[model samples]
Target chain A: MTEFQAGPLSLSFGRKQVLHEVRTEVLRGGTMTALLGPNGSGKSTFLRAVAGVIRANGPIMLDGMNLARMSVQEKARYCAYMPQLLPPPVRMSVVEVVLLSLRLGGNYVGASAAMERVDAVLASLGIMHLADAMMGELSGGQRQMIGLAQALVRSPKLLLLDEPLSALDPRYQFIVMDALKRETVLRNMVTLVVLHDPAVALRQVDSAMMLRTGRVIASGVVEDIVTPEIMAEAYGVRARIERGSDGAAMVSVEGVV
Target chain B: MKERSNTESVQRALLCRRLLIIALLLSGLIAAVLWNLVCGASHLPLDLLLKALFSGPDDHLEGSAGVILWQLRLPMVLMSAVTGLSLGLAGAEMQTVLDNPLASPFTLGLSAASAFGASLAIILGLYIPGLPSEWSIAGNAFLFSIGSAFLLEMVVRLRGASAETVILFGIAMVFAFQAMVSMLQFVASEDSLQDLVFWTMGSVTRADWTKLTLLSSVFSAVMIWSFRDSLPLTALRFGDDRAAGLGVDVRRVRLAALIRISLLAALAVAFSGTIGFVGLVAPHIARRLVGEDHRLYLPAAALSGGIILCLACLAARTLVPGEVLPVGIMTALVGVPFFLGIVLRREKTE
Candidate 1:
């Protein structure tokens, strides 16, 4: 069964088409599935469509109900979409942003519960020391982590992250992705992430939906479909996909063809 | 958790500051009223003034003092306080909701709209023979104030809906309104032009109990309903997109704030002519005393505004040998130096 229940989605911006005949769904309770694509490949567009920030042609169904049909408050409760992870557009403290996520539901989990959730997410991401920092004061990578911590407070049924790990340095890259993977699995959620590179794809993501020109180039389980042909087609690069002695996946870009 | 505690403490201090402003304002208003009654061109002793107020209807101890206090001074004092209270709080709301420090009703073209309307009434009265000029003047003032508010809102919307951009657009509209008012002035008969000019300068001598009562009621209602949204409005200092992500509907909040501001400003300008500077500078005083928290900023602004206007009116009635200075000029002159001091001091501290 489709984990996502999206229906007949269409979108356009003025005279240009952003999403065309776009349809996607995950297996319920799936792994960190990456929405892989080039620039303007509609990855961010699709993520926002699911979050209902922008109105689109089709209905996104979570567990079979139409998503846009839900009220703004309702959609916010079921899905937490982290868009581009820019430093919060204001001087709000990190704790304020995190607390806001829990408050969005109006369930307004009491102070203790709200703090516990914030503390847990911050600890998981290893950024408890910077809790008091203003969002505008943080480094890009640190801001991205804080952004992730904010989304994690809600523990939604589905998480839509736009380039969740793109700006992160190598040491913290896997750590962030690993935490996302762990949270999705432990919480039994369906997470759709947008990723740019193969390093993130082969190392962390469970499935890949490679898109080009607003169309899906490939989609399947990580090992079966993340082949040299699809990578070359999607990124326009000649690439090598190999299995090492340690039985880990390896991808190298030979060059653009 | 610790930071949350800090926020709460800051909020509490702001509340204390607001209450202090309220206490100070009430005391100042009473003192001004008494001063207006006592220190007139004729120095009536305290005993005679008390007799005039309390004695039997038939036993008239002082005729001029009673006429002066009841008919002239009381109404003017009340009008000054009411107009200031409404305009100041509304200005605070405008600055906060627009997220621009420079926002005020005057900056947003409202005062110019009022001036244009008053100018039109004066210029047209010579040609039109039968219309009640007083009603025409008040009606035109009220209509144009609302029209300017709508125009300001439209320009702001057209400018991409950013708060800062909207305020800039409003400033542009103010210049347009002022240009039209200047054109109207260019053609007026000199005698009528003098009356129009004095109205533009803003005076409270025309005040009556009826206008005072209505303004007080309208401002009090707006302030009460708006208090619940004060913390949320401050949350907007974090920016609207984030505020919305945190459960505030930014557009809805902005619209609500705009309507209240429009209503209050239009009423004040209509009833008391075009008072300026009260809206622009009162919020700065409130912010300095309390801090950036709107929950307190708004009420403190309201009270401080009332005190400033009442004291200015008292000075207008008593100062400069017998002539009454337009309260607007007095406020503008005093407010400029004070605002400059605050700005300079703030620059040093920062």
Candidate 2:
């Protein structure tokens, strides 16, 4: 029953505008949306702007609350942002890193309650065995999983993940997407994920937003948005969309436009 | 359910291990303090030393032992402990906020600026106008070191407080202040030059109750402030963007940490002169012992700092009987080898 909306967001780095009056369609809870674009198209910037990780000129409202006016801490109460980079290999244990998300922003939980939450998130992600392992000793893919666990542990209303599956192998990517979809539906949370592969987006997400040069090229259901013309305009690549036996759309990139 | 139980037990064991390490460090500090109390020029036997300590300073006991205990050994011992704790805590925070293991109070030009201030006071008799001549050296050192901290803060404000900017600017300040100290040294008279050099060598022999009380109070205040932000500080190790995403005000945290580091480090260097390596090496030792969860790491670093200085003080007293060497020289001599060992061991392990 929750709704998230951000619009007319504009941001610039010195002279170059990274996002220009960009807006997202009303993203409802209990569904995953893909943010797809080529390099320099402001996919990450738009996500960061919505999450309030950086300042942008516009309003962001979630469940009738104005997020743009909120402080970073206040925004964090409802939004969980997982950056594109994998968590660095520090000497902290995986559980310790995941537990850190609950330690701040005025939502202080007691020790046992926090530990229960961490365990639940790790178990859900199937990284339960890594709970006691040092983050420094984990592989890149495992660290990415840890990052996802950290994002989910807070149980925020809006989950913003920037390229969460980039470092993951194909199996892990599938597992992570499945976990994301399950968690989003179970928690009834609004999830926005930046993804590179339109094929993955066509197969996984319910809807997609395509951006080009900091503006939205198209936004609609995944089937309608992954058309060959939009793909060429957004990613400079010629593509074909074919329906599989299961009646799911799958994108096949032919070549560079 | 069994997996949950196992994980909980493993976490409990880690906590127990950390607590035990901290307990051991505390005990080591106590032993080092006692050893420092007894190892001076006229060694008071353990029983007599205990009796004198129990009788208190106000009670005029039997012998020169009481006089030495109250006047000479006690002030010096307490000063070393307090100063060591201050620098160690400051260094730990500095390293964390700056995100570089090499960062310390010394790396930030506080010691270099204090050396210049002490040199000016020693060679030129230049001091704060209202201060008594006897307090000139320490007061001037305090003023300049704190002033340098303010200058660094200004640079951070102007340049966005990135780790690289702060570290590079601090290095620039270090060289600038060292050059000024050398200029002062070039024109100093032979006697004044020797006195200035001795002051820079850093000894607690000049420790008095007034300086000790001021430094102890400051150290306690900074320690409380640091622990208050321990969770956010620990989050910072993950990186600024990640910490920010977790609702930490990274800029505010870094600024507050800088202020605390300045107060503790500036005061310690002012009172004790340029005591190096304790700030640089103590945190590394603490990290090796307790890992990087600042709650435990901070206290362990403080205790390790105190122990290192206490042992350095003991070496200063005993290295040449009846002739106390500069404790600063002892720290560098002791610290360099130990620091090298930690570095080499870490390299091998990695």
Which residue segments of model 1 deviate by more than 4 Å?
A: A1-3, A27-36, A81-104, A109-155, A161-189, A192-213, A219-257, B1-70, B117-168, B188-195, B228-235, B276-297, B300-324, B330-350
Off by over 4 Å in 2: A242-252, B117-172, B188-195, B337-350
Model 1: colliding residue pairs: A9-A58
Candidate 1 residue-wise lDDT at A230: 79
Error of 2 at B339 (Å): 5.5
Error of 1 at B167 (Å): 4.9
lDDT of 2 by residue, A1-257 (tens): 99988888999989998897998889999989999999889999999888777889999989999999998888888988888888878777887788778887578689888888889999988999899999888988889889889888898899999998998898888888999999999999999999988889989999999999999989989888889999988888889899899898778888998
**Model 1 chain B weakest lDDT span, ten residues long:** B3-12
Q: lDDT: which candidate is best?
A: 2
Q: What's the true lDDT of residue B297 in model 1?
A: 70
Top-scoring candidate (TM-score)? 2
User: Global lDDT of each model?
Assistant: 0.72, 0.85
**lDDT of candidate 1 over A1-257, digit per residue (tens):** 22675545678888888888666645577567888877888877876777776778887877877777876667767777777645444444577667656765567778766777777788777787777666667877787777778677777778888777767788667777877888888777888888877666877878877777777767778775577787777778888887789988888888997
TM-score for every candidate vs. truth?
A: 0.74, 0.91
What DockQ does model 2 achieve?
A: 0.71
